[model samples]
Target chain A: MPNTDSILRFEKVTVAFGGDPAIEDVSFEIRAGESRVILGAAGSGKTVILKTSVGLLRPDSGRVFLFGQDITEMKEQDQFDLRARVGMLFQESALFDSLNIEENVAYPLLNQKAVNCPEDQVHARVEEALTFVELGHTLEKFPSELSGGMRRRVGIARANVTEPAMVIYDSPTAGLDPITANNIMALIVKERDVRHATTVMVTQRFQDGAIMARYKYDRATETLVAATPGDASIAGLKFLVMKQGRLVFEGTLAEMEQSKDPYISKFVLRN
Target chain B: MLDFLKSPVLAVQEFVFLTARTIRNLPVRPHYWRDILMQMDIIGVGSLPIVLLVGFFSGIVMALQMSRALQTYGAVSQTGPIVAITLVREMGPVLTSVVAAGRNAAGIASELGSMKVTEQIDAMRALGTDPIQKLVKPRLIATCVMLPCLTAIADFVGLLGGYFIGISLLNLTSAEYWTGAYRALEYDDVAQGLLKPFIYAIVISMVGCFYGLNTRGGTQGVGLATTQAVVSSIVWIFALNAIITKIFVSF
Candidate 1:
């Protein structure tokens, strides 16, 4: 039985590359308009979970439901149609090097048959998406021409261009200076709050998750502001801690702070 | 023993599946005509000078060698027919394909290998573009269409090289060489020449793509894949040539 309100549900899903399972019996659900930050050390299966959620990697066992449909065994062609409703920014940004910024960002609009954005509007929409990331002038630039932060921003813009129902970010701010990382996080927050799209972010940095939980993007001031108590967005922000290939913790930031497990505390206590 | 054999067996299985899927996508929509044409320029047009150079040299060498053997029999004037028949039947297709395997297979492997390591392939999939349709099919189609064309050019250039040797070195008249060369090529030789390159095109492009999309590790893995693509494509080209030639001879 699938829950209609849940946008992504992983039910005891296990994925293995060769011998050992990369993600074992991982189960979690993200409802509409909610935000989840998955935190883990290197090789803790964070990216694997993100890939599995979107049907990029099929599970070895159990089931996965996206938009309340069992997608565990969905054919790849069918998955493409279903994936049109979801946007994902892969680790390293993954912008096609051969395509310039405009073509890269316009890829989803043109390629995704399900998105089916009209031809006449694609350039305008690409410009608007680039503008949203404050990269309006970089349409002709290649990915190599941009700095790391700029490339990541382009990735964010591309992900949000289709205005998908949910967007997944894999280590959106993994290897950046603090300022750039924060700037990237602010964009993610803006995307989440403005679109009210379901957001799932995987990060190695605990600060990334903390920012996601505590801050709300304020359109009026064009900055991230502290969320007031009882803020609905704050309530929907949850932290998921993964150890090895298993989900060790799932709760609010406060619950994570009160956790006594050394592995869990390692994330909250460290930078 | 089982563990040692596992990866090789799995690799073969994956290759088979990949080949089948690439063939399946030939008629599918979202053809990416732009990509196919671009690959044509890269694989076909890009390989032209090298194919020509190789063809010319191979022709010159064959003429030089065959003339010596013919001179011993007082038949040095027959250099044109020998070179032409050899070039059309076997040398043109195999040598041109071998050159393409070295050039384009390595190119495709490194390009796609970089993309794989960088997660561009996964991103393509997530963006609702089937990588097989977008990446593999275009290369396959372009190679299939262009390799045979390149082979034709190589065969002609090779015949011209044989002509240069026949007139300048052998002291044979233009009519003597051209007549012998033109008359020596049968329908079977032409068919065999074209068919060999067509089959090699499928092998080179698919093997390059297979090694590329399956690349692992980092930069080191990309280098390994590029080398593997060239070696495997060349080996497969030779093996397939022998098989096809044997069948043609039997017929």
Candidate 2:
């Protein structure tokens, strides 16, 4: 069973901009080693919630706890320290264009002072991260020179380089081709399983969430194996369906499919 | 109308707030010295040739016009002192700042506005990096340090150009032109020359960063920000120059 200790908790958080609420009274918690997928359509404030979790945006009311510490009241410098342990993959794969692939991957580590290493060690670590994302050969290349899929992989490498305790992925496969999307999803799942890291992935597609919830990384075959009947690891993946900045449904895929709620039914069987 | 006055007031308030935040981040840790050096090269070294060209031409034009006016008064020999004083006290710093406002200010705004639209700025914040420290302060310090140096270079070049024009066109002797120019310079004139560019530097850097960081929409927004940065920085340069000149006169 995943640890009951919560890695992230948002209690009745209300975030608004210019007197209009983006996400209102949203509350959810993810336990350690558990991955929670936030399913939302366009403009449903999924990105706002993720930004609030990292203290990039402050809520109008309510509290956010990270690793059991209240970050709502933390100082900016203290928040910086907390954010170092939380990795985020932006929707646009926001790789630093001014930096080469290796430097982009090493950015979080060097900028956050999360790792203290000599030049060679930093190089080795960057190479290892890019290798994990299957882009080791592109280390010297600039992000502008890379394809969209390659840039996304570089972003993943950067996010995972810090080995964050909690990883937040905002539409990790939003605009990719099916094959590239699947590859990115597989990479995400592999990182989660290998590190047992708690993850919060927000996606518009229901299938992406189901894929993460129902697969386990097999070391022997080096692949994502489907979970068998009564697999406990399946419980580690939970889903939260959001509509217009509010959570509409929360449960397993089976439960979501069987739900009588018209919205959930329509969403679960969407084209 | 009340609404008409409120927008400018709000703009001033936001500008003041940004300046305060930038100052607070200046002494804070995690200083990006490497970015500072890069900005120095971009602002100082990259803009040197343009500054020289602008200064040289302005000096020649000023000498030609002043010699004509003085010739009517039967005082063509006074062109050297008049041109030297005008270039040192006013034209050198003002023209250099105008060029920088168009070049560096627009460049900073377009670059940062593009980053903002592309989500790189948000990514930096997510990665525990303060955009103010990493992005703004380096450019801020670089502009401040380089503007004064650039102005000095421009002043020297302008004086040389004026000397060449005075000896060639006005038929003034080389020794007479040099003596008049040297005699026209005072401690206060030199101080004011250096002081104005330094002040203009702050205006240019802060306006660029302010508009850049506040950009929205997309590529269109970046274009708007670049235009606004240059326009606003130039406005502040001229307005602040008036204020500073008034204060210097009183002193």
lDDT (CA) per prediction: 0.94, 0.89
Fnat of candidate 1: 0.97
Candidate that would win on lDDT: 1
Predicted structure 2: lDDT: 0.89
RMSD of 2: 1.9
Best by TM-score: 1
**Candidate 2, which segments miss by more than 4 Å at Cα?**
A1-4, A117-119, A229-232, B1-7
Candidate 1 deviant stretches above 4 angstroms:
none
* lDDT, residue B131, candidate 1: 92
Per residue, candidate 1 scores C-alpha lDDT tens digits across B1-251 of: 58999888999999999999999879989889999999999999999999999999889999999999999999987888899999988999999999999999999999999999999999999999899999999999999999999999999999889888888899999999988888888999999999999999999999999999999999999999999999999999989989999999999
- For candidate 1, lDDT tens digit of each residue in A130-224? 99999999999999999999999999999999999999999999788999999999999999988999999999999888888889988899999
Cα-based lDDT at residue B222, candidate 1: 100
- Pairs with backbone N, CA or C atoms under 3 Å apart (clashes), candidate 2: none
